[model samples]
Target chain A: MMRPTNTWFAEKLGDHGIYTQYMEDHHPAHMPCLEIRLLDWQQAAEIALRLEMRLVAVWATEGGCHDQPDSMFAYMGLAHPEHRHVLLRTQLGRERREIASISRHYIAACRMERHMQDMLGITVSDIPDGRRWIKHEHWPEDALPLRSEFAATTRMAQAEGSYPYVSSNSEAVCQIAVGPVHAGIIEPGHFRFLTVGEMILNMEERLGYVHKGIEKAMCGKTAAAGIRLAARISGDASVGHSWAFAHACEYAAGIRPPRRASYLRGILCERERMANHIGDIGAICNDAAFSFMHAQMQRLREDMARMHKQLFGHRLLMDTLIPGGVSIDLDQRGCRLLSEQTRMLAAEVEHLRTIYADHPSIQQRVIGSGIVSVNEARDIGLLGYVGRASGNYADERIEEAYPPYNELEVHVPQGRHGDVATRVWARFEEIADSARMIIRLLEQLPEGAVSNAWQAPEAGTSGFSAVESWRGEIACWLRFGDHGLIDRFFVRDPSVINWLGLELAVRDVPVPDFPLNNKSFNCSYSGNDL
Target chain B: MLKLLKQIIMTGDKSEPLPDSDAIELLGEQLHAHIRKHFAGSLAIRAVDAGSCNGCELEIHATGNCYYDLERFGCHFVASPRHADMLLVTGPVTRNMATAVKMTFAAMPQPAFVVAVGDCASGCGVFEPDHYAIAGAVNDIIPVHASIRGCPPEPADIIRGILQVIARRAA
Candidate 1:
């Protein structure tokens, strides 16, 4: 019998004919993994559902023989009820490039499964939506870029194929196609809405317009150098993506930086959260034709961004977090500046919140538009403010408790209704919470070194991290190779899950209100497409 | 209404002088003169995001914010390429968005200026110089009149780049 574990993994998975193994090298030291046979792929999903675990991410990497073109492995990341994350793995050979669909069990797995199918040619059998994802007819059908055998520099001529967007057959319903290029200064994605008059009958989003092949670019690069690529994965979530990437790498190498580094990382992440929340609140109001809040809130956000430039050297806090620690240190002057800024921002945000609440015109436009129910939110595996607004109070900071969040009293303010107004309110409350946390972090910051010399982990060592970025919980998986080069890197941005939430939220909403709902959600197109 | 008015008055204006104020003042005067001479001082721009991480887009959006107030320089972002006098493209044009970018440029009127906005648009920033997913820089995909060189250029740099493009057209 395998060693009995303290986690619910042993108790729930013991009878499922699958054995649980602790990832001795996996960072943060809390992830428990189960290696299952390829035949038991769907069975793992069944057990996960029975245990009330949410499917987080799915991807494929080269398996067994690195030189073999036909060998690959599929991995599933699941967040458990016990506050621990679990990874399920299954290796496949040339004979079996297919597995049963887990989307039947977890709706969140739909796009990820299609992504794996498109990127690695791993067929996901029984996947409800078999349409091509992440490849807008850019590459030929035979090209699978994630496989080790495929050269990264091999340029392919753009191929032509039409996306079969789901259409309506009724005369009463008319179809409207939106983008590959939109009117606003935003990222690209196509939205197809089947509507009757102004009421949306159904909505479908076709993304991948911004696929830069980040995973393909990171191949054969050193893990330390990959941070730059990670930061670019989602420009707005730079700190979140890079910090999660660095955390995974450090844990895989089993190198912990000084305690001061953890506190500083917390400060950077909270600042990122606050800045985005403030910006999104303003943008949502702007979408509703209320420009006053947009003007006021943007002024505050710009001030904070300028302060970030003064302290960390990047207006958006990009390139600030690296493996084993942070790139910049906070001095006494920096601390004082941060404290003053946070205090002032807290007061100003409260004033704006009052203005937003008191304005009846703004409330009229926002209140009842684009409401997502709690059940729908849970079904879609929504994270971050999107889920929080819908009553799914699952915050990785408080639940998974990654340090220094483990020490701080992290407040995740939640909303009851998942409408545009509630989502905006959640952002307002989160800004307040983030400001409070930043002030606390400064007061209790430890005195020590900010960065440590990065020691490369041995080849074949893999690490994982789930960080609660401002948008949501961003999950990163990293495997190191010879001389600290990254063998395979996978990052699952929260936008992947939250985009589905957007589709579900806008079901009955009017056509014009789509922008308001979208801005409230503020899902990242580049992040999701990557 | 009273509270809203009170808040607005108390907040006051946070707009600052554009970057390189002296040069911008001259360029602004020239840009307005050129616009008036040509299109009655109405300069419309359309921003296309080919495949950026959105760092550049954020700065571009910031340009429209009250602080930068890009419209004061006689250029405002428009909805369609047909209405545009200039095309401001961000990101290293990706393979997927190439056709769309070309279509947008083709749709614009004659003598449309293209300003490639960041290092990525001018040249692929972090990716390998010639990666598979990338279809070269903005210039390789479309005709670029001026390029702003920064990882993601600040709002001031973006305002300056736009003014210089129009100012050059005027000269």
Candidate 2:
């Protein structure tokens, strides 16, 4: 029997220089959860594996008495089906601050540990692979990114030279470097593809080409400013990012949004999901050279965007969701109009899907184009439609059942094939499901204030909140300072887990299919870059 | 040939429809009003990413989504500055992207509106000071007309920013 609270084995492990306790604070939105404090990093790793906690995020915070500047805090999130969350906190000092690498146990920790290493200058002992992740070798080795004392205005006097990419020795393996600047108008990322002829033998992606110093800029910002930062983490997922940040702040502050506001939030989130799905379906078809489906999907996507504009007065619904509640509301006439549009759109989608299913060319191109087995998906901990397509149905909407999602009986559409076609089908299914959910939510739309006045929490309390964005689970953790401002905030986007699947899915597929495979996963590069 | 002709007739003529002369005059007036209100008469704009850290790029990409219909306004993101009316960039302008940023700006045609979308772009947002690669804010590289500040600004803010630039040019 798996009870929610009994999921973690941390209770049985007991006091090995680590303080394990559940934090139930009402002030911040994410307060009512479990927190474990470890005196050292090795202890954090032991408990993480022993307790079977997934490494959600690893972020460092500069600590010490206001005068002494060398203390650091490394935070990690661990979870099980039984307990909603288990937070692991470790404290480190300048003299003896090395932690054992947990990347061996949890593969997800690889990038996070590297990020912490680059930012905080923390040493991870006995790591199998220790190549620089975010930090290029061109920069001074002594320069730590997340240090509080690091000067902001100082510019590097000399232009650093190019980074040396690692070479491969496998037979017929030649490296193909693509993008920091691509042919198309897109964000920058460096992809080193190791290929023999057309087939990709292995692929190594070097990102951070767009690394904006987001974490550093976050310091000294007010809660409102932080929400703006959160929303910007990934522009397409603004509602999700803002909701997650606000959810954390609200948890720390112990504020609940008005019921109507929560319902409206659901509506906005569904719209975001629908818009992305429609665009992606089109893009995927375009990648497959199916021009007809591509054009139709684009038209459908445009229609949805128009509906969004008519309702929210913004096409992407940016900044519509605030900390206490939503910034916009739907009137009776607007609600009626939205309901009608949704019905029409739903019918159009069904008709288009029929065309897609009956088209042999589309089916042949997509059916098993980029097959990621269920086992591989589970092992990699894939998220959203990509994960759902491979039978890993972990939707935060259904699992956590927060706010409006709790009101509507949400059914997550899942598939077993785990291929491009299956992923597309799953996405379509979710789109329809979201439309239905939106209709239900609108019909029973609550009437109340859309927002509540918010105040920062008093010092030394913390909280965590996880929401299912269109992509997957987005978890936010927050700690309040004495002055009622946010002391520490950490967010983990679904892309962090989903990107790993890309490396696996692209293996052995010809370079031509890379676009198709990438589109099927459609993980946000910006979301993960954080 | 006969079957094709019949099919075309049934589909109500496949060729481009010719405008009626009387209605054309009225339609032209409406078109002018719409263009004046929306397009801002061939204004040039440049995009600068102060230090996005790329979340904004996804939403920026969303601007091209059929639903958002950014092209309907005659606004398009151009690759080269020699032909570009605007420079749309994302991220915090890392040490690496700085030179590219400057080069991009230099390449763009003058009288351009520079729009900074995302928090990192506007104020370096979260990726500031301590980031190893960042040079500074987008303002450090180029003057900005409007700043859509989100971690990544929603596609709506982006569209709004474009409209604001056009509106200012028209004014």
Candidate 3:
């Protein structure tokens, strides 16, 4: 049955040279959704705007063997209801490589285009706000990082000095520069805040100081090894990162993980979600100067981490999901232990929610501060808690149910206020839902082999996978080499989408509340730097 | 005052069990002995990232997290040449990141053990090597210790790889 919405999109976009590939009727377990590919960048922007497709992510692909020499290819994943992903591909040659900026159409494309411009040197002409998004002035303009010809030796010989960070000059506005090295142990990134009497007019984030050359190093590894690297992208988001990687690899290989392995993957994924939510809620409260809540929530997070260690033998549950299946299996004892943990966590979270609700200081700090309205949330393409706070309700696990998600019942908590309080509440609600999903999944756990013996796929095929990471939707694209190694890989972390929202949401708010607002969002800096 | 009372009643005291000082010490000693036995002489490692977009840095950092502690194993991320044992790198090494990558390797002490973690580090898992920035695999940079693979390897895998390096050195 062709949904009316998709039919409307097909008609409108088809006239404008956009190709729509329908996969809605097909089983989602085999193929998640239908894919549409646009021939050029202009058509991509036009289709995205006209169709109102949420700009899920934008990534660049530098041609290896298949790409025409002196040319680059870029793809944009635009999503809509009915779980459809429209892929827009544009080709740019060495010299004449300018494409229209989609930022004017979809605000989320601004940072992504800047990222492409920094990495690939492709210019997004008419970008309303293109002031060097990722690249600082430290590197020469000609030195694009993602270019194939760019050698690794040049960085060492290059002189080391501070990159000229552009600052906004307004009377009474002073700049506060924090980090690369903070007072505490946090990831490396620079935050430049333009403030006038504790009122932040504009805040700029300079990340990638910890850029460890992850992409360049991935050139010749095997499939199995590559999955391990994906799991490490964010320690806390291991399952989400690996699931995205494994999904892409499996799609490329045309293999499905056993039902049991998929169920186990769901269990691990929810465990990750629960752990992060517990930690985040506490941290947000702590930021509001509520020490007691922080201590209690930290304790809950620790307990969940212990459960993860007991069940999966690794606290973070990394490397649990391989391409075809899982590395570990939950026996009967493990299943029982997980259920007990889930019940305990659910009870604790409920109690904590009541305590949090009654706290006036937390209420005052969070209720109306850092607001991102529903329209703004949609416009910026926010996801996870940021989107849920504003009532977007787009969780990939629920919207496009994959594996055990299809079987388990998920209760999505939505808020209309779109403030710090709403985000915190949404997280708490997700924790409850995640725990319930785990128990239900464990009950119907399939009986089968945990993982299949690894095998390599034939070269030159590409695939896409999306997983609901703790932050939001994480999408991955993978292509393999002739020698059975990964040829190209792109990971789109939720931080990429949420960071802009952070900038816009925090505007006009007092600077003292910055820490609380920032902690409430808690988007990972390391996740976005790559 | 009322809110405080409610919170106290709502969240019953649930404290995490502290790691037994004795157990941690014993584990530390055993780990040290294992490293000594496996890496009889000196051990040097080089870190390689095949391609990670950077999520793996967290667990890589977690090896140093106050919990699941890595220092007890004598494993550390060294900065410069002449004083390094292992290469603890991440990512697929985009065309842009490649240079700093080689320089870091050149600065490392000899007989280095290269441990590639995460999908991007192992193979260009998610990143296509053909991209304008990414060049090739970790092996393109240096020889490896053990491929403790994942999108990002768990801290345990990292710990396991260091132990393997020790074992290889003993052999």
Candidate 1, which segments miss by more than 4 Å at Cα? A1-7, A21-28, A64-70
Of 1 and 3, the candidate ahead on TM-score is 1
Tell me, by DockQ, which candidate is best.
1
Candidate 1 local Cα displacement, residue A25, angstroms: 5.5
Query: What is the Å distance of residue A319 in model 2 from its true position?
Result: 1.2
Q: What local lDDT does model 3 show for residue A287?
A: 76
Tens digits of per-residue lDDT for model 2 on A1-530? Answer: 11244324455446555556554442322223334544445666666556644556666667523213567777676655444455665566568667677776777777778877876788877765676776665666666767766754445455365665657877778889875565344566677898889998887777765565556555556677788778777767888888988888877676888999999999888878887888788788878887666656666665676677678876567678777888889999999998888887788778778777877877888887778899877666677898899987877777667788877888888798888899999989989998998899999998889999878776666657788888888888767666666665567889888888888888888898888888888776667666
Better of 2 and 3 by lDDT: 3
- lDDT tens digits by residue: candidate 1, B38-135: 76788899999999999999999888888888888778999999999999999989887888899999999988999999999998888664777788
> For candidate 1, lDDT tens digit of each residue in A1-530?
12233356645676877765555544444665556678878988888887778888988888532234556778899886465687877777678788888999999999999999988898899999999998777579988878777788878866778889898788999999988899999998899999999999899999988889898888788867899889889899999999889888887887776789989999999999998988888898898888998998888888888999999999998998888899899999999999999999999999888888898989998998888998888888789999989988778898777788888897777787999888888888888899999999999999989988899887777888899999999999988777779888888999999999898889889999999999988899889887
Docking class of 2: acceptable
lDDT of 3 by residue, A253-277 (tens): 7678888999999999988999888
C-alpha RMSD (angstroms) for model 3: 7.9
lDDT of 2 by residue, B16-109 (tens): 1112334433443443354566445443333444345345665676666544555555666654566666666666667756766777677666
Query: How close is every model to the real structure, measured as TM-score?
Result: 0.97, 0.82, 0.77
Q: What tens-digit string does per-residue lDDT give for candidate 3 at B106-153?
A: 767666666677666777665555554455567676665667787556
Q: Tell me the number of clashing residue pairs for each predicted model.
A: 0, 48, 94
